[model samples]
Target: MNIAKHMETIFLASVVIVGATSMASAAVARIGHAAPEPKVYAVAVEGAPMAVVTVSAKRLSAAEKAAL
Candidate 1:
């Protein structure tokens, strides 16, 4: 068998496989069933005193914004 012909066959087979797989998955999505909504609950925790934090930064200039 020729190498080129073998590769062509393999590529065509892969294309068919991918197309069928995608179509099947799409059909399944169209027939989707209702999924139960997740139950959520609020959790509370005691707050502890946090140490004072300080942040220092210079405002960006108009030139800096334009460059970005």
Candidate 2:
């Protein structure tokens, strides 16, 4: 029950508690299963003078999001 032994016991107990909590968290899955693919919907409206623009494999970068 010296100061050094008391501090060592507290450190060991904290390590064990943190390790067990991490293991338990890793075993959980969101929504109890894998997520489905996200769908993107598009609609075109009549405008001044804009031609059709076709794009495949749609994706947005961080810079594009910041510009919005």
Candidate 3:
């Protein structure tokens, strides 16, 4: 029947599209996988003397924040 032929054509087209997309995605995946290995970088942090913190410190105003 004509309907069967049409259905066959649609199914074939969808299969072709899916196959093409899967191949393209596989190629893209391979290319994406070729990234350079990340090296561990050693950061030199200088030790700063820490002072004792107390709740007796005065709260700064908005003007103080802007100046700092």
Candidate 4:
């Protein structure tokens, strides 16, 4: 009976630890998913004959547009 109780305690502790770890991983994944995408920039020299630039599809905010 004593051994059975010990085994039960061990099993419950393992379950709790696994559940907590899974919850933490899921929260981290959700935070990563909610993050903003990285911005892409195109660079060019001012007076270069072969200068060409491509911009990302992301829309700029009003302040950002005004600054550009």
Number of the top-ranking candidate, with lDDT as the measure: 4
lDDT tens per residue, model 2, 1-68: 58776998899999999999987777775436678898868556778566678787758799998998
TM-score, model 3 to reference: 0.43
Candidate 4 per-residue C-alpha lDDT over 1-68 given as tens digits, one digit per residue, 9 for 90 to 100: 58776998989999999999999999999877677798869667788789569886989899999999
Instruction: Tell me, by TM-score, which candidate is best.
Output: 1
Error of 2 at 34 (Å): 1.6
- Write out the backbone clash pairs for model 1: none
* lDDT scores of the candidates, listed in order: 0.86, 0.80, 0.86, 0.88
Give model 1 RMSD, 1 decimal.
8.0
Order candidates by lDDT, high to low. 4, 3, 1, 2
Once model 4 is optimally superposed onto the true structure by TM-score, how far is the C-alpha of residue 16 displaced, in angstroms? 0.1
TM-score-wise, the better of 3 and 4 is 3
For residues 1-68, write the lDDT of model 1, one tens digit per residue.
68786998899999999999999998998898767798868555569555578889888899999999
For all predicted structures, in order, the TM-scores are: 0.49, 0.45, 0.43, 0.42
Model 4 residue 37 CA deviation (Å) reads 8.9
Q: In terms of TM-score, how similar is model 2 to the real structure?
A: 0.45
